[model samples]
Target: MKEWWRGAVVYQIYPRSFLDTSGDGTGDLPGIIQKLDYIANLGVDAVWLSPFFPSPMRDFGYDVANYCDVDPLFGSLEDFDALVSQAHALSLKIIIDQVYSHTSDQHEWFMTSKMSHDNEKSDWYVWADPQPDGTPPNNWQSVFGGPAWTWDNRRRQYYLHNFLSSQPDLNLHNEDVQDALLNVARFWLDRGVDGFRLDALNFGMHDETLRNNPPRQHFETEPTRPFDFQEHAYNLSHPELPVFLERLRSLLDQYQNERFTVAEIVGPEPLQEMKDYTKGSNRLSAGYSFDYLYADDLSADLVRNVSADWSDAGDSGWPAWAFSNHDAPRVNSRWGGENADAETAKLFAMLSLALRGTVFLYQGEELGLPQAEIPFDRLQDPEAIENWPETLGRDGARSPMPWTENDHYAGFSTVDPWLPIDMRHYALAVDLQQRDEKSVLSFVRDLIAFRKSSDALKTGSLVFLDTPDDVLAFTRGTDEGQVFCIFNLGRTQANLDLPLCTQTEIKFSNRSAKTSVLPETIPAMTGYWL
Candidate 1:
């Protein structure tokens, strides 16, 4: 079996915003099927679809009611099978989101568990008896806000929810629950899917002892919610998580085809947890964190510092990097500031692809779409509503994709989408950019092609080159060949003496960048590959 996922680019399609063919104002599986060709044309190896399981819409599809079947809002089982068939024919692998940590309160297991204390499925979810004063079990807080525990009148106990109250955390310590979750994975594997992007995986298990989390040290940036106030030592990231991951890895090894798994590890200590979760082949294929997703600024030092942590050692697991996702703000707005341009977008695309790991490109990223301004009245995300003025919320990043400029609804749907389409996105629509050769869309396509042709960029050892603070330089190489990559992340041109072979040739350079007669200067917001 080929390890195709290593250094491969995976495009993430939030089904709710990809394309809506159902006319119900929501994107569906058939909608994704309709755009497979467009996706394949982008030169990505796989597509990671966010959760489309039956959901109550409380936290959108993240609050899953069922694990095995497709939601009626998206499509039927037949539609999903057809999508897989079409994607496979296009030589595109399908990786679906697996929310193993929690399930919707509407799930049958949770419904039964909350019915009584001694029910057959009572131990399926994390439940605890409240203190004598009727407080929560511990000082843990949900990612959204407030206490992590919610009182359940039916069971006369409190249930753990790292996310919304409607989404209950599973008691993964129970052998029966583990077996059931494994069965869910088997069902999807039988459906011809390629891999899974495990969602909020670090929150899957908690400390059995229920100890209090220590207060976090003071930082320049203040906490946005109660979640950031503590060290999070006991609430999640249990020492036993790797054991469950090993079991998942063994399950994937049973298949004849190469099966892949990439976990989304988000916590106080994400970098260490990323390494711990994917240290060996017996664990996940790769794991990613919010390292780049939530960064306030992008600089040469930031890149160097983050990349330096993941060494090139054989036992270390591969890292997957993403600049933006459904849960975070767009990279252009976060990194490039308010007036970020096409050149800035192209630079980021190059930087992410040139890194030493798998890459995930969110929907509309190739089009250089900025974060949409979702008004308070139109906000649908629970987190955004709960933490309104403090945060921009995720709804802005999840606006509907603009396929055409002149379409009545930007070609997403005939009716207004679940989330409004950002009018600014229409100017950067796919149809408009597809016709312009110098557009960000075209640049990303050419960039992916260039990455595929370079052995160094694909699976080479990365070494940081000593350079000025504003300039980021690195070498990705093996015995067969080597590639030198340099990026001027600053706004002014940077002049530097580079350590390079006299016979070196420029393989690719962004539009704004230029090499001087002496090859000692790089224009701002430009990157070069030699």
Candidate 2:
């Protein structure tokens, strides 16, 4: 019943790779149940378990067939209930993913909808009559590198899919589809789930007019598609979508605690879109975009820009921050070199917590694990299947969570893992480092405790310090006082002219890396909060 997501730390668990109790090389509810303690120990407030619904697994569970039931690969309804009980028992809220934007073509609704053009289930999905040339209904291209529309031979029409051809986009424009999604939410809410992580929520609505997206003008930039080429003014972020978000909020509010919904909007214009989705009190509680996840650099100016972007987002809405997720390469890989060390990773984790918003921590991020160097033959992600050299795919970031050293599969499973266990991560495993005073894991614990005790870091205003590049300085403040936080984002020991923030207490340090600010010198690659 508590609205605790504000400034909360959410631990994202990709169910398939977190553990493999079934020994089928994929993780399941029992595996998650066994590892609830690991999640609880991380000091996160909640766990956003990625989709485990009835799925065809073509997209590795993103293509949902049934929203209300657990897939056999994961477990049964009773298994989910047990997982929920275990999480709550550990004082952790459970937020499951809701893939409402599309469903596996195998879904009953899609099956029925594809049977006949005027069938009762027709219009539940985004379908259109083929052009006179019998090509796709529109110029829209699938995100996986082809036509977004797949011709349904039975109905003699083309169905829309933002992703693969096997996953058909739902027509949220249809009132019945909206009702059906809400019913799915109701099913989970009644089952005692805390919230829903709306996958590609902005993609729920498309332009009813079926207008063709404009051409890409910038040739120097990456190639554009129907997906990324246009401003997407009409195809997505439709004015009608928020009405449904409000409806979703209205339904969630019926339960004692209004359940949270965080939309995943990926594009060049995500900041504005995030704001739009969480604009009014009636819509979603928070929205997290892919700014940090996709960024290759972590400059101080970039941090300041994000903070200023949402300085006045208001209580009706808030920003949720995540540096990495399944879709992204680990920050360590994106921001590599000496700066990718454990200490720097610890600092980033602390800085994320100190920011005035909710933080979503990927599985191995707390341990400072970089992207796994997955070989070409061992890859399992569809993205990798499509584009290998240019992209490492999500599997590189999802190697099993290392738990112990000197054990096969890094203690993640009793059998072979879906992906090879990174032996280099063994030294950073939980069992090995829990006792160390200087471990990233320990720093995370200390930082989470600090966040819990400090009002400034929890629900306060953040002002970026006028510090130089490579050295990020910010003051998190409540009416109680100010907490000064600084991070040396670079490798070399750089000196900066400190303005007003001269006298400061060291609240926490992620690294002993040195630095010099006008008069006094600090350690390199270190982070400090006062």
Candidate 3:
């Protein structure tokens, strides 16, 4: 079977903001079905839907109450089946988000586990007795804030929660817990999901000894939360995680058709962790880190350094890249700053596409949507709400996807959207961009098409060429052919000498002119594939 995910582009749909057909002021599975043609037309190979599982909505859909069922807020199991069938018909694979690290406090397993100390499921969750001082077991902190251990009076023990107190960490070390999660994966596989984007997979297991996390020796900047004050050594990235991944990989192999898994690895040593998690076929197919998503700058040096790190991993490792997602601020605003424009958006699209690996494109990214200016009063993300005034919060990146320009709600909903649609997004709505050939949406479509036609861009090896600062030059080559990719990732024009031949031709370029001869100087935010 072909490794369909290698070099494929996966469109990420944050279902809550995608489209709403049920008129409940929330996006649902039916709405995704309605937009299938739009996504297929973009030339992407797959669509990765964020969690739609049954949840109490405390951490949105990440706090899973039932892994095997879809949340009624999104739709029913039948609705998901229809989505899979429709997406398959359109030649687009379906990859659903799976949160295995933790479950909502309301989950039946947690409920049963908390009822007593010796129940059949009592050991399914991470529970420990309080210290002599009646405090949390260790100095570990929650990513959301506060202590990582939450006191549970029913069991007279504290439960571990790497995220919200409402989300209790699962005891992945237990064989039964691992088997149960595998069964959950099998349920979705039987339902015809092509793959999974494992959410926070590195946090699946913790140090069984419950040792305190040592404090960081240096501060990059002022720490935002207590979680940042210490090195996340004991709380996550347990070595036992790869053992569970082997079990998952084995389960996925039971099916006849090829199945894929990509882990979201974020912690103190994310780059190494990403490589470790994906080092062998017995584990995950690929793993992505927050290297680019949270970056404050996008320069040639940064891209070169990151690409070099991945390249060093060799054939045994596969990497996934995403510039923007539900968790981070939009790339245009984060990297391009206050004066981001169409050219800036196209530059990023070209860069991400030219890189060697699978790419995950967030919804609204093709249209170059900037981060929404969400007010504190209207914010819905708990993380943002908790760290407001200090941070912009994730709500800005997760606003409703604008479809029509004229609609008051941007056609995301009949009434008000769960999150406010950025008024500026109206100008860049899909309908308006569909009519303009020069729009960012159109450029992205053509770019994706260009990538689909080039085997060198898809699965070939990447080699960086020496160039002046602010200018990134590289070549992606395979047995079929080689293509030289160059980009000016700066505000000023850059001059460089290129060795070109009469046979050399421009494969694609963000610049308007299509010429065989290479220019001595390229304008800022310009890129070319030749």
Error of 2 at 503 (Å): 2.4
How high is the lDDT of residue 131 in model 3? 93
**Can you write out model 2's per-residue Cα lDDT over 361-466, one digit (the tens) per residue?**
9888888898888888898887787777876688878888888887878888888888887777888898878889788888888888788777788778888766
lDDT of 2 at 283: 80
Is 2 or 3 the stronger prediction by TM-score? 3
Evaluated with lDDT, which candidate comes out highest?
3
Better of 1 and 3 by lDDT: 3
* Alpha carbon lDDT at 358, candidate 1: 92
The sequence of per-residue lDDT tens digits that candidate 3 reaches over residues 313-357 is 445488899999999999989988899878788888999999998
Query: Cα RMSD (Å) between model 3 and the true structure?
Result: 1.3
Ranked candidates (TM-score, high to low): 3, 1, 2
Q: Could you estimate the TM-score for every candidate?
A: 0.97, 0.95, 0.98
Off by over 4 Å in 3: 312-316, 501-503, 514-516
Candidate 1 TM-score, true structure as reference: 0.97
